[model samples]
Target: TLSLFYCMVGVVLVTGGSGLVGNGIREALGKHETGEEYDWVFLSSSDCDLRDKQAAVELFERMQPKFVIHCAASVGGLFKNMKNKLTMYQDNMDINRNVLAACHHMKVQKLVSVLTTCIFPDSIEYPFESSQLHDGAPHPSNEGYAYAKRMLEVESRLYREQFGHNFVCAVPSNIYGKYDNFHLEDGHVVPCLIYQAYLAKKSGQTLKVLGSGAPLRQFVYSIDVGLLLIWMLFNYNDEEPLILTSNEEISIGDLAQLIVNAWGGNIEIQTFILPTAFNLKYNAVRFQQS
Candidate 1:
């Protein structure tokens, strides 16, 4: 059913190409040594807003990429998410609904959508498997965002089951690496901690993190997750949801230390005790994927 003459890879349309995961996938795919270079088109928040039905349709009609990789969503750390529930829910929900609807309209050959590990609930089994996704309710702090991602999973599943489509969904663990959001208000734990600490070190001031440093989180490097995405898209039919992660869990305190080490052992990182239950759950994810 396949031919050796098929050398040209499909044109790739990456939503949120400016974001960490999208950028990571691009680098992984375009690596000079081994990863085959493919034609790719990047769209940021401005180029084509998925929230607009007309714009999404117009963009889909123009390039008509045979493959679409959706890495776009409104996501951030616990503080921002807890404060802005409606924004997170509405923004992420709109993006997925409009984009997936456009893909169905354009009939793109295949799609790869990324979801967060936060959607997998608090009582996650150790070494969390893809099968345990539906085991428990999501963490309350991020329940809104998690609900949107779960809806994404369901929509993609329906497409595959009813229409025989290739809408692949990947649920990756907490991801971090280069190009991660480093903004003081917008960045996640790793970038925020590293950059803020580096600044504090340079300015000779005290640095503080939000929690008591007890929250359990599992982190995967962005590129590793990207590689897993492309691998599943190319090599498999994607019968089940694939998780781009390792079962390694780390405490918020220890994670801070890792960044301090990765920051080349130059900065001091400190955490202040917060009254949040999220912090008391450190190492909770250790048994989640084990």
Candidate 2:
């Protein structure tokens, strides 16, 4: 009877649950057809300071989660990452280390950690392959953050190799959707443009864009990323990192226009500085849920 009870029940823990990607995963899980069977726990930074190892261990021990979606990390926009490289590096390293260690110690059935395209080498070719992850150095603009995430992949593989843990990594492209950070200087492109457009429309001013708007990027919808994460949690069980990205590539200019058109405002392109080399392209991900 006790074994039957264990088999029938499972706890799913989602860290950084208040953020955009975390919220997306939680919402997708809610809409799943068989979602009623598992227990899901969403933990934001406020729930427990995961940067603290003892606190992370205490939380894991108390929850005894069989599944963990490790989404917690120190994230910011291009400028923020560039300016606060050290902080981003240290904070994310602490969070990832504590969470992954806890997951291994607790013997969680599976742990899917989220990563970003920014971790790829700055000089890597387009249509990025998973095999080229650690081939070269990442862009200098955000190397601190990139290397921190890069280590997650390394740590995941090492953990699995040594302890035989089911620790996997998911690499997603630029994600945009609801609950995103809208800070003018520290937010991602999409949310920041949206906010700028909103302000421009309200004040009857032309929206200003920072760069030449030539760099290309693939922005996956947060909800779509969430669904994919859920699928990966159950369907994917390997050490190789899964790249989750769309094939549609949009220039910064077009993306800004889209935002302006949505808000019914005109845009002004200002070349404050030369655009950095941050273009990203990916082969279409093969998985989908019908």
* Top candidate (TM-score): 2
> What local lDDT score does residue 57 receive in model 1, on the 0 to 100 scale?
83
Supply the TM-score for candidate 1.
0.85
Regions more than 4 Å wrong, model 1: 1-9, 32-37, 262-268, 275-290
Candidate that scores best on lDDT: 2
lDDT of 2 by residue, 189-219 (tens): 8999899888877887777777778788898
User: What is the C-alpha lDDT profile of model 1 across 1-290, one tens digit per residue?
Assistant: 11112224546788888899988887777543332555677788888888888888888777667788899888887778788878888989999988898889988888898988777767654545666767888878878888899889989889888888899888777789878988877677778888877887778776677777877776788877777777756654675677766655788778778766765665666778755433211122121111
lDDT of 2 at 142: 89
Which window of 10 residues has the lowest lDDT sum in candidate 2?
264-273
Error of 2 at 28 (Å): 0.8
Q: List where candidate 2 sits over 4 angstroms from the true fold.
A: 1-8, 266-272
The global C-alpha lDDT for each of the candidates, from Candidate 1 onward, is 0.75, 0.86
Q: Count clashes in each candidate, considering only residues at least 3 apart in sequence or on different chains.
A: 11, 0
